[model samples]
Target: MYETFGAVVQGPRVEFHLFLPDNARDPSQYFRGGSPRIKQIHVRGDFQDAVGSQNWSLDQTFKMQRLEHPHGWLYKLAIEQDLNDGYYQYKYFVEFENGTQRWVSDPIAKYGGNDQNENSAFVIGGRHTVVHPIARRRPPRDLVIYETHLDDFTAAFRHDKTPVDAFRERLDYLQELGVNAIEFMPWTAWPGSGFSWGYDPVAFFSVENRYVDDPAKPADKLVKLMELINDLHERGMQVIMDGVFNHVRAGNDPNLGFPYRWLYQVPSDSPFIGAFAGGGFFEEFDYQNNCVAEFIRDVCLYWLDRFQLDGIRFDYTLGFFRQGDAGVGIAKLIADLHQSLNQTGRSNVALFIEHLTDNRFEAIRDTNDIGAAGCWFDPFMFKHFEYCRNGNIDSGILRILNANLDFAPGKEPVTYLENHDHSSIMQEAGGRGRWFKTQPAAIALMTAPGAVMLHHGQEFGQEEWLPGSGDGRVVPRPLRWEESPLGGDAIGTRLFGLYQRLIAIRQRHPALRSPNFFPFPFNHPEGYGAFPEQDVVIYHRWGQAEDGGFERFIIVVNYSDFDQRIDIPFATDGHWEDLLNGGVVFVDNQKLRRQKINSNWGRIYYRKA
Candidate 1:
């Protein structure tokens, strides 16, 4: 430690300075508070029985000469030297009237007990700077996304040093599953709990302490997590982090009135609810509060700048909307957040909003039109699952499809059959008895319009229902990395392979991923053609002028028990290949074509160049 000190004493102010370390950028050379939960720190020292200012500042050279002093304050404590790696013990000394000095340390130190003698310590590491370009780019419409939680991903396998490498190993499985993006559940730091599912993050600036063993140092768990992320990007996968910006845990002391003294909240005099959503679960702040905006903005920037994450799926986004042009609509916050992030001079990270409201789509459409975030098309997923899984496919499913095709002009909405909230598809609609019935509906979900989401292990029929109430959200489901095909014939594996094939096809054919697709009139018998029908629905993606323009593809779904014959009317003079079935039908002119399909086989016919 390079130790030096200077003092120009005064009553309410003083000048205290220290020498800087030779290598400032070295991670292990710096000092870190033990708990990731602590944000702002307050340190005070005394001299001649007088108390001094607790607030401190550090300059770029790690030297501070002048500092504001409170009245009756005289002597001040300063950074003697840049802290080195490993645990070091230090405390503030207060000189009393009797010439006695008292030493004190932070009360919130992690290594707790009656022993304040050994002060808090932090291990250090090098900063992470690598980022992926595709994270923030405008993606294709036909994306297959997987929702995952970091703690859950590693918890089941973390015996010795396995959690870090375990996630790395799973990357192959995710790629095999054919997902374009992986949405992580909350993994931020939380104070009281076995696992928080990252919802109760105490420190917005730091990565979750639980995931990283020695978060203070560069060679610790946080760095390992970064390695996992970088590895994922190398494989051409997009990653989205779940961002929670609504509330924080209750604080023991109130500084700015945000429950925890650490968070900056709008003063109660401001025109907003200091406490909202009853029982003070979510505190409402005045959007006029600049500090509030600054805090969240810093958090956003920190992740994008540090971790190189691709996107952020904001959780409970509707909770913070204020009543003004820039602060009123949830859209405004997202728009502003995206704009600020763009100034970082890096890849643009995608934004997605999640709110439990019918009007949520309105905000998404408005903001996305101006390039804020992509649409979260949950309603479409809900309706499809309801029709297919519940065995209630009828006019209702058609209504949903029509609305989606009409409302979404140039947006790629995220559509999913099941997510973390609805843990199990079988349990949501009915019971285990209804599991077999919903299998056909799952197929429709994968093939239907817009972006698609698949919960982890949902493909191979792993049904683990997460507890809805409490901290159990972070618990991982028993991952069947061990593939178990249904009936020893690998039926589940076959279905997963089918999904993989669709993803490959979508990636290869740009039209499948295009946002501009026109729906054709499917006049099948019994009105089941496009009414949640899997046999005879036709969809077309009008291609851009660069690729010879306007590609028309017909998607036929044969959900019936028997094979069907089609005497369809088409004005095409070329060869057509079936996407689902392994066969080709040549149509030199407008004529009828006949084909056979399995019970739940979905066939797509496209023109071959």
Candidate 2:
């Protein structure tokens, strides 16, 4: 049986368990045999008095008792006392044998302090509880994901501060846009003063206090976050958390103090020491280590169970697999995570990995019913961007589009053109409000027989580059809600309407979401023998029909800057409806010749037999 490893409180008694592997304390495991030895470990915090005053001092300490377990030694402490029914902060005080004393927060703490010190906290008898709604469930392939940072999305609207409530206020806008899921770029607590992307996570279990309206109130942060999730669920949007399990921010900055460094030091024998070149910006966890593996598993399961999150997108999965054996180690770990989630009877919960390269797809692919639901497909975005910019479709694009048309197929790839990692389509097109040119790319992304995603501002033709440092460091910027369609921007409203129309078309047609994609050889020699130029491509998607016929959709895209006429070989087309413009075209001949098409435009023709 599996058990939780943090503080478990019942009534007035709280039991704490800390797992320290035997090798963690072994002298031979260190470089110079001078690692710190356990002298005393104490839990110190403020206990709420009847008068509502907190006594912020150490009044109780525990003697170290070690018990052998399968993974390592377990340190246990149980206390019974009268306390107020609210949240309280606490830290572990550890004294080494060499007369060095340090204060560290619990590695498995579910809550933490609001100050810069970032101490851990726990709720005694709070009102926060996980409530799973039945209406918010959807399959992975059916998700239309919208990615955004919480601070970037809400900070500019109110006095440069982004509270949880402010983000909740924008749910109506997202629903109106027809997105079924929202992927938040890491909201975990990190060590930063101003706004950050939250990728450099310091506490995986705790929510960021910067988003909480009142820090003095115990469980306020957790409650607010729960409310946000509940609100999203109620509004028909599933929440997908962006998790950074590859590395953690661990450095001794003068501002953060030495306590940050003490929390991340691993045993010398651990597998995470020399995996990367030089030293990475953050401390990477040793996936091979039992304790480290358990910690990550606990973190993943904690959010799924406590917050009722629908899914998790693990950041930089490529980094984890590059460590050893070409990601076989991390594959096993992910398999275990998938298995654990399955045991909970929530099989529809999605799991995504950020492995951008095409060859890395096999490593994260679902095997033995235990693997990720899909990976972030960047080749489609890169190739589509290049074609849109140059108006030339190379053979490489054709090959990538037809790489895996049959096996596992569309359900294993999540396609997108604009996300937080890359520049927006508007910025790539010389920063003008020429969003019409990018409409072809949007058509390709949505109708490509895969799950589609969009960045926060991409729907509104946001022209400003994502505000951040060169190395993907997040910086706070002014809220551009006024630039969005919801804020009365004309171009934004127009672009938003286009996005809404395309998304609705995808939802209305089952063929668009089917796994079967057949691209005709428009320019290929000895193929369809249609357009021999590289600037035009056509594809067909079909699904089984209820009337024993087939539901067919033919998508034609023109990538050139100059308008052209192309000949399409239609198999007995009577009348086809252009989904983009709702225009009807009649075709009597087997070959529809000299069809006029605009430059950088695409159309989805629904064949009505």
Candidate 3:
């Protein structure tokens, strides 16, 4: 078994493993290129059950012993000690070689935490497993992932319970939308104690206590979250957690700081802190150190084993991996994770990254080497955003839709129009007045290719604009479900019905899920661009049918203000069902001439030969 860091419960005793590398190395040029050695270490807390006395006295501390396996020893762990079966809070006090010391929370703490202050704590028998079995895995391309924040997604629906339970309370609403997967924006504890889009992560191994109705009992926080996961799995919905391993929150001050960033007397001497390929945001982790990679690798592994998550979306890859790093940084971490997953007989668990970098369309291509299934389709989102606003795709829409056309077999794209980082579809459609403009975009999102994503409240046209950058972007905007089609909004009603129908169409057509795609090989037009002048784009997707034939589908998209007529290239001459408006048309000549596509709308025709 892989060695676990943090307070790991082993039967009657707990093993507290701490990783601080460069212990016994020669001093180099930089300040403690060779980190200063720790003269003494102690775990002081109220872990012991003392009925008559208060726990966590600074004077009452447990001494630590170093484990030496090589020339430069790495781990300093607490001596094994049996304790009562219950929860306890603790922190580490380490004295370094330069004769300086400080008290800090467990950087790898698995449980127990608050918003402003940090206290490392864990239960004697705390490891939890989801009672509901993991839902059967689905290919990445077949997923319709709905990205939502824990608090905002449920804040408007219900606040009577924790956001996790609130989501469960509103579970049927999401299920009715036909999304098979739910991707939660970084839930590994929020930034400080305040509301966040969750990008600024302070604690990696613990759940944000504020999400719980009762934050005082840290022990209950994790299990309750697990129960929510169990319920999602029971409903045949996959759960994906957004993971931030590139960097952590910095600063020695309270509310939004990390303990490991300033755990030692000489802060820079800490092995896990520094800079690399990470985006210049917050404090980027120095991946040059093996300890950093190992620590995060352990975190991912523990989550998989304990939480039974179906997928994970690595936040940003440009900030995590470096050039020419063959066996280190995120590559090593992903390799280790894949190896572990294979050993555990896990399959079809999606691992994707946000790898928008220099030539990002190509940067995404390189993720195959690091063991990622694919990447967030940044180019696709930007292109479609412009298309939705401008009413056309001047650039080659086929290239964007047929993503990973030249990628390795297993690698694919996770496409989306709006996620946490962008404005809602209503906003992109130039407000609810031009809501019909979003119809084609939504049609393309579901009908084109790859794993699809729906931002929370996007199905019903939630329009709330925040700045593209700075603190203003992180504020919460709860969904207005009452304004949905079922409620009263005119635009929301139409969009919601369209979304439901499109999702149903996608699920009903196997050709939509197939990799076989073409840009309507026109016989007369002799052009492939879905540009403004053309006003129409036709494409075909087909899958090998059970009867040695092909299950074919042709998609017609209209981006202009007026209806356009086109010769749609059908794959077969047979009964074609118009999946969009519900009609049947006979195509005896393998082509439908003067087929009308409405303004800012589309049609999906499924062949029933």
Candidate 4:
């Protein structure tokens, strides 16, 4: 179905197709007289016209025929010639019946120019030379994701803008941190300022040339991106790309000769636009339209096929729904995308969504029988943060700890304490200006029974609020690696060492990664300390043992400022080692071991056989 739209290249002949909605062409529905007549479709590239001139002249332009379809008018063009391999850019030149003409980029191009100027380009017979590493599949439950903006991570060390290749140079450091996957924020081409979170995607298929050393050679970016992916894959790390399909940048008006006007809608009565919301620059995509659907599908497929990415994290699924609806179309779109990607033989390719709704999660669960991964557990983070700051364990914390068991069984939710959107935990903790206080939160996150993630600089304790263009916005900011714990700072060093130990323990222990969470009973008179409602939380993670029993781990946290003692009942009377501090304790009586945990610290005890 996607083949019905966009340009399809076969040998020396290239076929082009464009769909103009019927309503858009109607006189009364759009412009007063009528929509543009689309007099001609013109395409020019390096492979066309001359051998190496790559010039676009009147002689190079050819006329395209308009065919009638059920959807609307379809402009078709077939060009045959002796075109060579490499980078080729093409655009559509259309003349209106009213004698107005405009040059527009190809909406379906696999590559394009920088954010300042959008011109679609693609590789002609250019094959990837880098041998991809053998595909290694890890269970969703075992994933330790590290999310970062590529430029932010690399630019922190360099004076100039960091490119994808420059970011790749830091793979060894990531591998050292023991993160299994890296989630890069939206890298697609966007307009206006180069420093951004990259959520405003103007060209979905093209790489952001702001990070590219050479914008003239479009294929160079593609090659460098591939190299980075291959390098990551070889290091046994998966690559997850952040995708923004909910909306497009809104400045392009139809009257301005923008070709992709049909992709968005700017209704006068749009509720999303207001003084508080900056007049709504995000025009929701026309997902109900077939042309838009195919375009999105092609964009997904292009990255998956070209770069062999491991997964895609779609931004804001709330925007996917139509007005006053139950998001039936949104569910179908996700299901269809999952099915299509699986059909590509990359069945292990993960699909995640940022839909902050319980109904959306249930819908995705119902649609994806194989189980679709959900967003980061925000409630868990918030509740834990509250407990840390207030030094109180409420019902909210208990509910969050037991969420997976009560709500969605057998599904692994991505968990995180801090991400690119909000300020770091240190910043939220009343500007403690130290990462030491956040250790308990970090322990809880890594030890939680699900896939976990750490935002860039979180491991080394980045104290500054995430850099962004404006106040409270996700603009680019310099990452001061010199202040990092790994940079030999005492406080940062302690935090980094603790993180490394916690992550290594999580990776080694199967019980911590298990979906089965058994909250330790603190109701017993002797189990919980003097105050059961104090700032102390305890739980147990277990998995089936080889002997058909359970391999259990007891996790105890002291959120209070002073020291506390937790008398947790052991599954068996034996020696238990504190996984955190590496101290071994012997339990003679069946009652259990009483361990004294330090203030603002936690301990993970694994019962020795």
Predicted structure with the largest TM-score when compared to the true one:
3
Q: Per-residue alpha-carbon lDDT of model 4 for 1-609, expressed as tens digits?
A: 443466677765567776665554432222211233455666654445544344665443456678986645777777656567766666666665456656666655556644344656656666556637437857667789999887788886645534686787778778888999889999887764457788877767777766664644555766778878888898889888899877777454432222465222322322211122112236666555544555667677777666787878877765665433333335555666677776865555667666555543343343234235655566666665676566566634544554454335545677787878777777765554635568778887877777788888878777666454456576566666776654777766677788888989888877778776655223334453224355677776778554656677777877677787656666667888888988887766644535677988988888735
lDDT of 1 at 32: 22
In model 4, pairs of residues that clash are 468-475, 469-475, 485-492
Root-mean-square deviation of each candidate, in angstroms? Answer: 9.8, 4.1, 3.3, 5.0
- Mind giving the per-residue lDDT tens digits that candidate 2 earns over 163-280? 6778888888889999989899898877755577777777777777777647456566677788888888988889999998878765454223223235333323333222432233
State the displacement of the C-alpha of residue 484, model 3, in Å, after optimal TM-score superposition: 2.6
* CA shift of 60, model 2, Å: 5.5
Name the 10 consecutive residues with the lowest summed lDDT in model 4: 271-280
Model 1 TM-score?
0.72
Q: Report the Cα lDDT for candidate 4.
A: 0.65
Q: In model 4, which runs have C-alpha deviations exceeding 4 angstroms?
A: 1-37, 44-60, 67-88, 124-127, 130-134, 158-162, 215-218, 253-259, 262-281, 322-327, 358-371, 466-472, 520-533, 545-549, 592-594
Better of 1 and 4 by TM-score: 4
Selected candidate, larger TM-score, 3 vs 4 = 3
- Per-residue lDDT tens digits for candidate 3, residues 123-147, read 7655465555465888787788999
**Whole-model Cα lDDT of every candidate shown, in order:** 0.50, 0.67, 0.74, 0.65
Q: Estimated TM-score per prediction?
A: 0.72, 0.87, 0.91, 0.84
Q: Clashes in model 2: which pairs? A: 156-479
Lowest summed lDDT across 10 adjacent residues in model 2 is found at: 27-36
lDDT of 4 at 591: 48
Please report how far candidate 2 places residue 306 from its true position, in Å: 2.2
